[model samples]
Target: MVQSNHETIRMNPNIQEKPETLTKLFIRKFKKNKLAVLGAVVLLIIILSALLAPWIAPCNPGQTNLANKLAPPGADHWLGTDRFGRDVFSRLLYGGRISLLVGFGSVAGALVIGTTIGAVAGYCGGIIDAILMRFVDIVISIPSIFLLITIVAIFQPGVEKLIFILAITSWTTTARIVRGEFLSLRTREFVLASKTIGTRPSKIIFSHILPNAMGPIIVTATLLIGTVILTEAALSYLGLGVQPPTPSWGNMLEDAQNFTVLLKAPWYPAFPGLMILITVLCFNFVGDGLRDALDPKGNL
Candidate 1:
């Protein structure tokens, strides 16, 4: 019955399994964290609502009803009306689009700036590395809030401008993180091998090195979105954020500036504050999950 083990092997090619890939392993590990998955789901729902605001919102966020000012949450105006009698629900939905956009835009811009500087500093070494890292330190020393206010004052308050402002002010952290990652990776065997083969410098940096450093870059970017949102909210407090008539979570809280509004119409501020909390917490959960999942030492 057990003729020859060799014969069984020859007849059972299908018995073998393919090696698991890094991406599959990462996904599998990420799925094990239940809270991260739940956070991702809630975040997706919020993002979808924001994207579908035009179709799902009961009224235009800017449309006001003087008679309905400060109306409580009800069927007529869900989540209630603000001081301007604008539909809070609609504003929240539309404002989500702005807030999410700012987060995404700011992070993306920062990544580009930071990654480039880091990659150059890491791969070049010597004078270039020292100069670039010192430049990053200089930027870090500058007061970010003041920088944001100055930029906003010059460019005017708007989503695009705020995105750029946050990107400029917040990129120092990313630059430092990326530079560290690059420095560690730049001396690796694979990088040396690529260089020895006479591969182009750009190719070595981007193709050989960048991919290796992407794990940290991605985690940082995820965490950066929450930071960017909080930054914009802080800017709103200083009146250096997206102006009224445009719905954004920051300016929505800006609506709660008056202490009286918090007391008289608690829902107005509560909803925005709740949204900010949820958004930040969800992102943090996802970032933590990704960091763990991407670790090479993690169980496969």
Candidate 2:
């Protein structure tokens, strides 16, 4: 009778699992995504190359060796030289640093500010939420690019100023996202239990609520990096961002905008444009994979 009962317990279909930790589950899901893995590898290579640009580059990106002006790719000058005799490969690697910096740095700034505003508004509700959301609505009503152009025009263009403008303009989306998240999460049993336990509102919001909403925030942030890069590129292409002599992909294309150069010095436009494409594509793939991997619904 004892053996039969033991066997019955062992064979029970309702037996619970050893709960998989979040890290373990995340790793398992992430590893299953081949494209995401490839994206990670590519992104890593780009980042490493950017960090080591000075050492890896054969020629100085800014130095004008007039003798090598517009030189095509060769054994010495890999990926060729630009109109001003700057090494294309060197500038590309260095440019990646600035582009990626702006992309990430601006998003970080926006994320912090937006998350705070959204969390506060959602958690506090009533008048505070109305006032803050109204402000957000006002900001969102304006054309973001036009607003950015106006701001940039007033402040003058440089990395810091550009970051500021982008940060200010970019946060609206994050605010909306977090606000929705907070609204939903505030009603959950865990949140009610925390409140009932006399957990401070601030602690409850940051500790319990924010963590639950981090998935969408992270996914949005990954996607935002690509958008920021493209925005910076567009601004630079318009001659309003990252001034000349500072190697950037957008300005590289701007410099090569001449019809004559487009046909003659094809390398000028091609390489930088290719970099933008690859970087954007990689970020998008990574974002998609992250969304699927992190989904709590297990839909992926």
Candidate 3:
């Protein structure tokens, strides 16, 4: 009788069950994505290279050698020299540092602003929600690129200014996503239980609700970094971003816009363009993988 009882307990579904933590489940799912793994490795390499640029760079990125102007790739100059005789390889390394900085900085700024607005609107609802959402709609209606160009043209263009502009303009999407998540999460059982227990509204929202909603927000942020990088590159290409002598990937391409250089030294434009493509693609793949990993329904 005791042996039968032990077997019955062992066979019970609830007694035998082992629940996985969300983070463990997410890791398990993410590891299965090959492209995401590849992207992460490539992104790590790019970031490390950018950080170690000063040590690894063959020559001074800004120091010009007029005699070696437009020199083709060789042992002395692996990627060749630009019109100003600056080392392409060195400039690319330094430029990546600036590009990555802009990408991360802008996204961080936007994330903070968007999260605050979204959280408040979603939690408060009614008049506040209507007002805040209408403002978001208004901002979204504007052509962001054009707005960015106009703003940069008005102010002195620099790294800090460009980051500020991009952050301010780019937050609407994050706001919408966060607000949507919060809307659904506000009514969840945990949230109601917290309210019933007399937990502070702020504490309930921040500690309970925000933690649950972070999966989507994080995925959005990863994807937004790529978008911010592209926008910064475009602004730099138009000569309104990081400015001359500052080696951002976009400004490097701007310098290579000459027809003669295009025909004669393709490496000048090709390297920077390739870096941008690779960086954007890697971020996108990681974001997609994160989304699939975080979804509980096993949907990709």
Candidate 4:
């Protein structure tokens, strides 16, 4: 038994060393970043609050008590009531659910479409690459927000519609980035070797190329979430996103835009704006950390 084990170890000496994956290595580096840890904690707290909103919210978010309109923060209403007497605190909690959902959902859709398009373009090369890249450029040349507004205008402003608009507009960036990465990687020795060895195209693209290209993809996806959230707020503010009585962060700002509400209930927009700022900032910080951590050459 001992002789057989020794022979196995001799056959593959590399087996004695620890095998660390990209995710494990990235995690190790991420743990060393203080700002990333703080950002992660803040994000976790927000996610938990969103998940537990029903149990934690003191009052009904959509329920209106006209008599208590514009009431200042106190024991009964921690964040106070808005113009419609809906609890600001509760609305903020519920609003986060929609905002975060849009951010994640749109980005997920973008990743799927972008990865597939980019991989095909890069791996196939020639006419296919030229055509796909031109399409990407055409999409990129147009103003994203304007395009989104135009599309959403046709569909009527709602959360699902807004998500679709953002997803369609957002995929261009992902495709551009992924295409660039794959373009550089496709000409490498390993890819050439895989081709020479008769490896399947799908296997070469996903099993080899995609794994190596994921670092930048992940970083971009993280940053895209922040962008998505900000875009959703902008759409909502323009009355082209989440509709009334829905209690989104953007429309919450709309409620506070009135002079009387600004003076009487400053907390309405203040809380929502603060939440947006902090959340976006955290995502940006996390993205930066991820970029530094995942750089294969340690060039951060």
Residue 150 C-alpha lDDT in model 4: 90
The sequence of per-residue lDDT tens digits that candidate 2 reaches over residues 213-283 is 99989999999999999999999999999998998898988988988777767867899999999999899
Q: What tens digits encode model 4's per-residue C-alpha lDDT throughout 55-120?
A: 999988999999999998989999888888888999999999999988999999999889889988
Give lDDT: candidate 1, residue 255.
Answer: 85
List where candidate 2 sits over 4 angstroms from the true fold: 1-18
Q: After TM-score superposition, what is the CA distance of residue 255 in candidate 1 from its true location, in Å?
A: 1.3
Total residue pair clashes for candidate 1: 0
RMSD per model, one decimal: 4.1, 4.4, 4.5, 5.6
Superior candidate under lDDT, 2 versus 3: 3
CA-lDDT, candidates in order: 0.88, 0.90, 0.92, 0.89
Name the weakest run of 10 consecutive residues (lDDT summed) in model 1: 1-10
Error of 1 at 199 (Å): 1.5
Deviating ranges (above 4 Å) for candidate 4 = 1-24
Better of 2 and 4 by TM-score: 2
Candidate 1 lDDT, 1-300, residue by residue in tens: 775755766799776555779788888999998888888898999999999999999998999888888889999988999988899999999989988999999999999999999999988989999999999989888887777788899889888878888887777777888888888988899989988989999998899899988999999999999888888887876778888888788899988777777787977898988999999999989999898898898776
Residue 154 lDDT, candidate 1, scale 0-100: 89
Number of the predicted model whose lDDT against the real structure is largest: 3
State the displacement of the C-alpha of residue 43, model 3, in Å, after optimal TM-score superposition: 0.4
